[model samples]
Target: MARFFSRDRHGRRPLPSDGFDRALGIAHRWFLDRVGEVATIQYVTAPADMDWWRKDNTPPLISGGIGSSGQVALTLHRKFIELKYSDDGMLPERLYELLITEWAALTGKDVSEIDPEF
Candidate 1:
């Protein structure tokens, strides 16, 4: 079985200095600390919903909310970061960075900002 994490919000804001990189670093490490011992991160993809038909057969990977344009609307479990773009050719790093930056600025908190652990 695999795990999925997601957050949803709406708004716009200005960018912060080094916010993306720092937020991503914190989120990545935080996720590892929480679920690393139990599950391993495999793939990170945009338009993740497209793969839902095959999710049952796939390995444990992180799936965030990616628009058809590849714009990341959310991150999943901090394992994989999403971006705001639409293309299979983009690198995960670029997506991750953009995701952290936008998400933080949008919500006024880090991308890793999660709800209660229940």
Candidate 2:
């Protein structure tokens, strides 16, 4: 099992992607039957500049992966923010949004509701 954390708007604390995947799996399955079980979630946060010297003799970067266990993880570095959801991949964007909105409604919160800083 992976650790989970709920993050408030300001993005102050980082929320584990693994937890998010698990939550999404349960919620989407119950609400839309769209989100499938997560097999892996990898996050690669890297700069757009320098070459990948270490990997291919390029620049500095962050890259990582997860497998099995339905995990969600994030890698944060400097330039990019990459979120890769494994478990058979996400449903269509429209369906994804509908799921999110429905979840918000169920929680008595508007889909647009988020911390101003977030």
Q: Give the TM-score of each candidate.
A: 0.23, 0.21
After superposition, candidate 2 runs with Cα above 4 Å error: 1-91, 114-118
Question: Compared with the true structure, what per-residue lDDT tens digits does model 1 show for residues 25-60?
Answer: 554565444333222222344344656545675432
The TM-score of candidate 2 is 0.21
Model 1 — TM-score against the truth? 0.23
lDDT of 2 by residue, 1-118 (tens): 4466656658577655554345445544443342333322232345554454456653332333433542433232322211333332342332245444434443455555521221
Best by TM-score: 1
List the RMSD of every prediction in angstroms.
17.3, 15.3
Task: Give the distance in Å from residue 52's predicted Cα in candidate 2 to where it truly belongs.
Answer: 57
- Evaluate model 1: give its lDDT: 0.40
Our model 1 lands, by Cα RMSD against the true structure, at 17.3
Per-residue error at 44 for model 2, in Å?
A: 33
